[model samples]
Target: MPLSLLLSLLAPPLCLACGAAAQVHQPLCGRCRGGLRWLPPEQAGAGVPLWAAVSYEGPARALVRALKFRGAVALADAMAAQMAANAPPGLLESRALVPVPMHPARRRRRGFNQAKEIAAALGRRCGLPLADCLERPAGAARGSQVGLGREERLSALTGSVRFRRGAAVPLRALLVDDVVTTGATFAACAVALAHAGVRDVGGIAYARTPGR
Candidate 1:
């Protein structure tokens, strides 16, 4: 933990969603995790199968908002753990966990990549290496993830997220992210992996949409 973050925890910041004092250095209170909805990967639609740890409502939603919008990088661990909780057996046994990358401009404006943070945290706890799966170039940075059709958006998104070419090793990967609304982002990352000769890529995330 950063010195500033460590000091902040000693004092204990008040939770935004609830008035309770947060014991964890991250954004959530103990009660919050309970209110969050969790989904397993196999329950998802036809696409890159996703493992969602919590729902997008209640405390999980609040925590995700705090991390993605309020610049709270510290909350990644909670999300990572929750995500790992319901991850596929294949992912748990995999050697690498790759984060779906954000465009540079958006990342710069946000001041952090929540997916990357979650990916690193997941890798640490799961004892796997964290890999970078996608990189949005100079132009493609913005989109309404909600409006896009799962298949269409997945088809249009980052198809060429280059990893190190010609590195010699067996390839079994698990994609990591903060959440999945449409299957778009997960599918995009899956496509990238497929291009890289990784035929089967599993996914894990903080949470997933309940329907569709």
Candidate 2:
């Protein structure tokens, strides 16, 4: 049997949100899924049009935290499913998905980049290509963005993100992240891609902080 099937037989899958029994293919129970506060389509207002699957609250927030902090990498597929389903028409067409790059030190500590995992899953579901071309140069600030205001986050991120040297820059790219709170990260990445000759840039996040 497949490993996933064997694992399920050994241990039934549980909801990542509310700890209820869940379907093998989904990480959230029906109730938690229904409780998700979805957001309408909106631009990043940071020169990159962005779409988010849900609001960063309640079960949605729980799911993000589980994936980011608890290393529940399997949840990436479930999050990507929502993003693929709710994405605006033509958003994925001919566009490369570029995950927001985590600093090398932080990635080492976390063992993986949550945004890259989400982007990989999203790319599979959307049938799009991924452009893993962005990076945070050495000496860039690696402070957490949590609780930081928009200006503060932007200031810290300015000149911090850049496209990898000699990597093929895509004509149209969509930046992917687990969440969008202040939009500073997306804006900073857009600037980097633009500097690298990317003509069109956009963003997609699994969740958006309310009122952001």
Candidate 3:
């Protein structure tokens, strides 16, 4: 039997946005999915041109929270699907999807890196390569970026990012993240990639904090 059919027989699927009956692999019901506010291609900040799949609001927010904190691994593929659907033109044309790396200790405690999860899913769906180009030091400080000013966040992150040793950086790449706030983290990552010989840097996040 097909995997989707088998899974459906085991448990009826529910919408990721609202707990309503949903088809196999469909995380959001029509109403909730229609409510998502996809941003325009030009709506990017920081020094790099970025594209976010959805505003960090409503169903999108709930979806990201589920993936980031609640261990909803299946949602990674769903979110990637949304990203692929909403991606700007030429996004998939990049050499590979480079996920923002998590600190080793935090990733160990969490048992996974959400950004890598999302990037892997996106790569599988879009046929793009997955590049684990950047990494954070195990000793890097781990704390919330919330409530910090842009310069403060940048200062906290500076010199903490480094390109993976022995990995050849692409000339152009898309930095994948689950969320983008002040673009501080993205800027830091782009800087590291630039130092590693990556020229053109772009980004794709599942959601962006609105009104920032």
Candidate 4:
């Protein structure tokens, strides 16, 4: 066995996928790594090139669940590290990061926007600014759960999100989120940004549900 492999065999690593105490990277174990479905650039997205750091399995699922359901803001940094490692180098061009916004009512109940929190963390790591360029309707929701077709998703939030009120116009942006189940949501966000006259919209997420 190679010296490194032999050492790993002797030491055994903790399962990074599930926090199981082993001896390797405390977060990602060899088994979990093997199971992770890291996508090639072709599968990420044709127009935007979706960037994902790890497969949504083992610890990755747990981490996303913990962050989303368990209110784990602390996990953002670790997640951001993964983004730093895997995100496209061009993602941070002249554009800043803008996380998909949650409805005010939902955000009020949750006390935070998880996507925004993640974008903030990633923005810090990438040394870029963040912009809240879009908003959901007063009582509407935008996501896979919303049950809207792609065309509807494009204009669903039309009146909801105000245009870029900031001094900057003709800016570029990268939208962020925890997971993308369908291309609908991201495409819709792109539509909204386009309506607002902003060019150059790309996206990044922690995970993507396979297939439509």
How accurate locally, in lDDT, is each candidate? 0.70, 0.89, 0.87, 0.68
Clashes of each: 1, 0, 1, 10
Question: Model 2 shows how many backbone clashes?
Answer: 0
Candidate 1 lDDT over 28-118, as tens digits, reads: 5667645666664565634666667766677777777878997877778877776666666666775577777877878899988898898
Give the distance in Å from residue 53's predicted Cα in candidate 3 to where it truly belongs.
Answer: 1.0
How high is each candidate's TM-score? Answer: 0.84, 0.94, 0.92, 0.75
Instruction: Output the worst ten-in-a-row residue range by lDDT, candidate 1.
Output: 161-170
| Candidate 3 CA-lDDT value | 0.87
Across residues 137-179, which tens digit of lDDT does each residue of candidate 3 receive?
8778768887889899998898888899999778888899999
Cα lDDT tens digits, model 4, 75-194, are 677677777777666765667788877778878888888889888988898888888777776656444546766557556544555444553544788888887755556666677787
Lowest summed lDDT window (length 10), candidate 2: 39-48
Query: lDDT by residue for model 2 over 34-127, one digit each (tens)?
Result: 9998887765646678988899999999999999998878789989999888888888789999999999988999999999999999999988
For candidate 3, the 10 contiguous residues with the lowest summed lDDT are 1-10
Q: Which of candidates 1 and 4 reaches a greater TM-score?
A: 1
Q: Residue pairs in steric clash, candidate 1?
A: 37-55
Which of 1 and 3 is the better model by TM-score? 3
Deviating ranges (above 4 Å) for candidate 4? 1-17, 22-35, 44-49, 141-170
Q: Give the CA lDDT, 0 to 100, for residue 11 in model 4.
A: 71
- In model 3, the runs with Cα more than 4 Å from the true position are 1-8
